[model samples]
Target: MSNLIYNEMIKMIRKKRLLVITLILIVLIPIFTYAQYKMLQNTIKNVGSSNWRTILQQQIVDQQNRLASSRVPEEYKHLIKLNIQQRQYYLDHNINPNAPGAPTFVRGFVEQGISLFLPLLVIILAADIVSSEHSLGTIKLLLTRPVPRWKILLSKYIALLLNISFVMILTILLCYLISGIIFGYKGWTFPVISGFQSKGEELITDYVHVLPQWKYILMAYGLAWFICIVIGTLSFMVSVLMKNTASSMGVMLAALISGNLLEQVAHSWPALKYSAFTHLRLTDYLAGNTSLIPGMSLPFSLTVLSAWAIVSLVIAFATFTRQDVLT
Candidate 1:
């Protein structure tokens, strides 16, 4: 069983399509980091000791003006209220909206990519992992091997997990390697504090105090990978149930895109607060805001995500075991 799993993992890595996808992530992440750095540098150079507090205040004023000029949706009234209250509190207390310390280039880059793009990549890779076998008529040949039905599905699932892990680690490594060359490794010891205000009260939920930025980067990377794995596993389950790669990919993509759309829409509907996609975005929790749905919390999000993962895995196993290899 172990050898079979290992062989499947190797096969996944050797596939040209997977390699190309990995290479794309590896190359694109650094380019994105450079672009972000340039924007930050330009902002600082132009702003000149104005500090983030002033910039935030200006932004608040601009938003207020927009709200007054445009027709604001009734559903977002609460959000507008929250924004106004928070901005006033910040001004009254002389609090800087920007935390004094920022994440390193690698951390920032990975954080940006993971929110939506990385999960899309995971879906693309795993959506066809099993379905492609059916498309190519290899499922019949594979089932004819001496291995038990469950073991083959298990091996493929394990291989998908390992590939996801590899992609995540490689993304982090490449981000660091490329960004270090340009950033001169200055932010490794920077402190990162994330704060959010609610009901006129400031809350600090997660903080990293004076640690190497790389450590923070790794922690964030791990959380991002966890979220991606949940999505990947869900997509893999869909792959097992579907016959064609296109259909598998379509189902997964539709779910993912729809979930994000729902999250945005959920901001308006107070009732849809329990949505799984609303919690799937790990960054929202890390930022210490309530889930997009007003009543949803971090623990609640974790429970919903875990339940989805477990249910999907069970279905995948059962379906694969009973599936007929007609090819």
Candidate 2:
């Protein structure tokens, strides 16, 4: 099993998938870092104060006004109310949610990227893991071996998990390092207020608590990791079902984009709560943000994502083991 996994990892390395992912991050993180920096500067300039408390209070007021407006959609009102509650919690506790530091940037980046950017990277890595074997005619050679087909598929799955872990860690390290250059590498011990829960349009603070910035980042990334793993597993299943790598990628991409679109009508389509894509923003629950679809708690989201991942893995292994490579 170890040998198979090692060989699969070697193939991944040779394919330069990790290198390409790293390159994409390298090219994109700096641009995002600069944008974050500019946004911070603009906020300070417009507010005429560098104090986060003052800025947050102003933001809460603006969001409240937006929430009160009849023009605002109920979907948006829920989000605005949640934002206001979180800010008010910070204000009451005198904690700086957006303290100017790399740790803060890391947390923000993960929250913003979890639903789309990170999943896309996982798709890029897993979309070809299985299909490429068929496309390159290596499945014939692979099956000709005395090893069970299950072991081969298992090895590939293990390799994909490791690669997903690597991509996530690399994403955090790069985001921190690059963003740190502009916003100093401090604030690790800063107090972070979390545990804001949403009950419909109301923000529940009964469980609100403070955590160190470092611990907050760890928890946020941990949720992000789960999301990426679910995405990677589904992509693996798609790669097994499709013979062409491009087709696998296209399918996964379309599914992901459609998930985002579905979020807009999540209330109308209550069944979307059962969808893997709707639960991709697991990190949002950690940050106390309201779901676009009501009735989505952390446990529910985790169960939905886990069910999708387990079902996809079963399908992939069952299909692969029973597949005829000789044809």
Candidate 3:
């Protein structure tokens, strides 16, 4: 089993998916960092102060004004209200949510990317993990080996998990190294407020508490890792079911995109809460962000994602081990 996993890992390394993901991150992180820097500069210029309190107060006022306007949609009003509550919490605690640091950037990046961007990266890695073997006519060679079909599939799945972990860790390191040039590398120990809950328009502070920035990052990224694993597993299943790598990727991409669209209307459609895509943003729970769909909690999201992953794995294995390898 160990040899099989190692061989599979080597194959993945040879395929250059890791290197491709690295290149994508290398090209993108700096752009993100620069954009963040520009946004900070604009904030300072527009507010005419670097003081967080003043800037936050102005933001609160602006959001409140928007909330009062009829042009804002109902969903957006709820989101705006939640943002107001979170910002107010920061003000009351005298904490700077946008404290200049690489760690701060990482936290924000993970939160923003959890639902869509990070999952897309996972899809890139896992979408072709199985289908590519067929595309290259390697599946027959793989199955002819004395090893059991299930073991072969398991090895590939393990390799996929490792690659995803490596990519996620690389994302954090590269983001820190690149963004630190402008944001400074300090602030790991900065206090962060979390645990805000939403009950309709009202923000519940009863469960809120403070955490060190480092701790918050770990918790957030840990959830992100789980999310990536779930997404990768689903992609693996898709890769197993399809013979064409492109088709597998397209299917996962469409599903993810549709899931995002569903999130907008999830409130009206309660069944969406059970979807894996809706649960992909598990980091939001740690950040105390409210979902448009009510009744979502950390446990509920975890259960939904876990169920999807398990079901995907069962389908992938059952299909792969039984299906004839004509390629």
User: What are the clashing pairs of model 2?
Assistant: none
Highest lDDT scorer: 3
TM-score list, all predictions: 0.81, 0.96, 0.97
Model 1, 1-327: lDDT tens per residue? Answer: 999898788767666657777678777866776686787677677656457776666667766776675477643555665565556555666654333232366566555666577888898779988998899888898899999999998999888988888878777667667666766645565544345535422333234123345565667787788888888889989999999999999998888888777777786786555555666666555534444356666677678878888899999999999987875
Rank candidates by lDDT, best first.
Answer: 3, 2, 1
Per-residue lDDT of 1-327 in model 3, one digit per residue for the tens? Answer: 999999999999999998999999989999999999999899999999999899999999999999999999899899999899899989988898888999999999999999999999999999999999999998888899999999999999999999999999999999899899999999899998888988888999998889999999989999999999999999999999999999999999999999988887888999988889888888888888777777888888889999999999999999999998764
- TM-score comparison, 1 vs 3, better candidate: 3
Query: Candidate 2: global Cα-lDDT?
Result: 0.90
Error of 3 at 15 (Å): 0.7
Runs off by more than 4 Å, candidate 3:
none
The reply for model 1, stretches above 4 Å from the true place, is 45-103, 194-212, 270-274
